[model samples]
Target: MRAFLLLLFVFLTLGAAPARAQQPTPTRVIEALYDQLSAYQLRRYQPDSGYQLLTLPSTFSGPELAALRLRERQLVRVDLVYSAYRFDPKFSQRQLNIDRLRNLDERLPGLLMDPSITWNLIEQTGCTTPDECQQYFHGFVLYIEKRYTKADTKAEIGRLTARLNATEKKIERIRAVRKSPGKPLACGYPHVEDKLRKLTKRIKKAYDCTQKDRRPRTVTFQAEVSRQGKVLNVRLPAVDSAGAAAPPCPEELTGAIAEGLAFTDGFLLGKQRLPFTVTGRLSLPLRPQQGFKVTGYYLADSLMRKYRVKLLRDGCQARQLRPGDATEEDPIPNPDPNVVTRVLERHPDWQKQTVVADVTGSMYPYTADLLIWLQLAAAGPEKTFVFFNDGDDLPDKQKRLGQTGGLYDARTNDYGRIRQRVIEAMGAGGGGDAPENDCEALLRAHQLAPEAQDIILVADNHTFPRDTKLLEGTRLPVKIILCGVTDHINPKYLALARRYGYSLHTLDTDLTNLSELPDNQITIIEGVRYQTTPGGFRRVSGRAE
Candidate 1:
């Protein structure tokens, strides 16, 4: 009795044990597949409903079963967990694995019969583990090796020859299209009715040429047609023969073709027709070497020159010129003696405007002139001056205003303490090779004066990644004036200006002497002239209009 009870207790304990601890229900494989499918859907034009996931055991097709087996090998842990729990509560873990393995073995042979479906199955399932994937990969390698060996037999020889013949036929078709004379005939056939007729005729000619054994020849011709629709001159420039066996066509053939085209009213009666040229080519498969060419001519016709122009009377009415016209004067009125005097006489509210200076590299001379003009204007504490730089390093030590030198001498100096302060604010500490993060600099500037309106960036428009980031993030209305930069302004800067509703000024030529630029709205000022030689400075005098 005691032995019987012990044996029964042992059997019950074995049956009640949990199914291999459930293995954390590995969901990573399914999640990864879902993510990949989502990414593919982003680029797909068709609806997602077209794709369907195949279930295992009964519903899976031969190719799908083979692919699953291959995936199972590569994604070993994930596949094992999936196989163990695919049917869940209906079947035990051991039963599920056995059923999947049996079904996979049975379906693989049928899957191998169709290579395209096999390829599709393998491609769709991006197996995560290596061992499981290598099983299917090894099978593919063996199959390919066998296929190549079979193809080498005498019976398969004709199949390979047939493929080559098909390829040759395709090449012949392409050559026919390339050498066709339709392109020349279709040129400038603007009217719908005329275009359709020309296109139809060209297609018929191309078909006829392809049917003949003689290869097509190509000829280029330049000609001039008079207003009365007569050929004035026609000459051949180049001739490409259809084939080596074919003789070159005479140049007279091209001339004849051009004469025919000229009388067809294709030439526009321009004041003088720019030397227009066309190529005439005969498309043939056998005689590709035969072709002709033609060259230049003049057209005599009633030519009408098309010119567009517009005139604006006032600066406010100027349609073409914007706020940042480079040739025009500064948009903000300069605080120079002459400009301030005119402003006082006209509106008497001349003192409210503010002045900002970009004391960056190569801008010292302009900044000095600006300061001098501001002093001359004398706005009696109403005028404000702001300074900034491309760099963002703080100064080592702050200098006393008058301790270093007299205020007059210090103020007159171009690149002195004031310039140093601007450089310090730019955070110029990471050596000379440090990248200038313009986005950070712009953000810092805004933080300093958030209330300021109409910020002007007076620097060369040499942009970087930081500039793009700044433009994308900020909504500030900032206009850019390219001072000394002549070429290669970064496109990102232009895009940023457009996005932020700002204007761009490209200043390459001289701006100090012009009284009035083509743009009437902007105000121009005469700054100091720049020279390469040492101690070479000249003053330019010009009145603003």
Candidate 2:
């Protein structure tokens, strides 16, 4: 039993030893290092290599193991030192420290050491994602060395320079692929160049065929390009291009070409082709038209009936009523002075008379009363009444023209009161000092009272050079009766009256009684009569007499 027990124990011990020896020691060490490195990578501060040294397998022995442990320790030291330096490489004394670290192999005393051993340890760490690991490792080293290094520090630079260059080359390759011609086929499409060529040929053919004669014409057509770069349907909207106002070939051709060029094989596999319609306009030079130059005119009889004046070959002539014979009371058979004098002699009682008044500034109250008299005259007398001076109704200078000086007369009629007001207004100088422009005032009054038959200006004739157009159209006879102070009348005012066919009557200072003037002259139109037949006959006729 003792021998069996001893043998069993030996067998068990030997079996276990072989199994342990066959185990993946290197893999376990590497995994343990990876875990430690991962922890260091994730930390805010770099970890010391002394702690990583514990991960080595106990079976690892002698110089090889020592060298491996030493190399790992140096790597860990490098990581921590790089991390610390990278944090703030600008710190003073950092340059001296980095130079000392870089010369580690030379500075170390008698221990077989290589500065590159630390770098090789990092590279051999078996990173599953090596690129990312290398980036972090190289970036930490570069960042640490940058502050102390000059611009020419290429030797001290990290592996990041090479990695960055490799990344840039990869990007260039991708861009080249994107720009490559016919690469659209990678997305399953036909070459755009091929479709464009076919479309150009078809368009040229259609254009030539549709516009055979070259006469101006319009055409309209519908077309569709298939996803396979084929022209599917091309037809005119009309039966042919002949009936079209403009040709459709150009637009149809353009649309077909565009659709073809835009076609892709990707569209061909799906539903890419779409129907498109086009229209075209063609123009040709046109000849000018030669037509009649029609004109219009006023017919002879039509113009004769419409206008009182007649159009002669040279100019217009007035239509006149011819007198059959002369009679005794035929006043002024002609407008001629001799005819007028002869008519006046035939009717001895016939007389041309005028009544005038002033109505400027303070004379307005007197003028209102005078208007009543004038209205009466207008209603009864056959003669005309004339007024002078700016009335109260004149624009821009309108004002009351009379005052009684705090006196009143209840028994006075309108005319009586007016006469009194006139006397008072005249005593006040009647606006003689009120910037009176006699010529402009008369011309303005003539325009305002255009319906009046005769004018009897009573101003002091203070201003001259009146506008003459106011009297140019007066057909009814006019008269001027000067009132108020003498020496106020000028030849210009008299000439204005004569210009408008008026007879002047001067009521020079001595006229105290107003009734001395003819009643017919003071009153308005009362009656008028004319014989229908000319003969030596007895007749008496009257209207509104």
Question: Of the candidates shown, which would achieve the greatest TM-score relative to the real structure?
Answer: 1
Q: Cα RMSD (Å) per model?
A: 36.4, 61.1
* lDDT of candidates 1 onward, in order: 0.32, 0.31
Per-residue lDDT for 1-545 in model 1, tens only? 34334433432443333312222212332222222110110111111121122234334567755664442221101111121112234545333333433444344422211111211111213334555534332111111101112223222334323433454465445445433212121112111222433533433343343343344444344555544445567555543343343224434344444434544443332222233233334333323233221222222222111111111222111112223332211123333323222323343432223334444432433443443333333334332334543232322122121121101111222323433343343222211111123344444445555665644444433222223334565686454554433322333343344445555545432222221222112232232221111111111121111
Any runs in candidate 2 off by more than 4 Å, and if so which?
Answer: 1-356, 361-453, 461-469, 483-489, 507-545
Candidate 2 C-alpha error for residue 502, in Å: 2.3
The top-ranked prediction according to lDDT is 1
Residue range with the least summed lDDT across 10 consecutive positions in model 1? 36-45
| TM-score of each candidate structure, all chains considered together | 0.23, 0.19
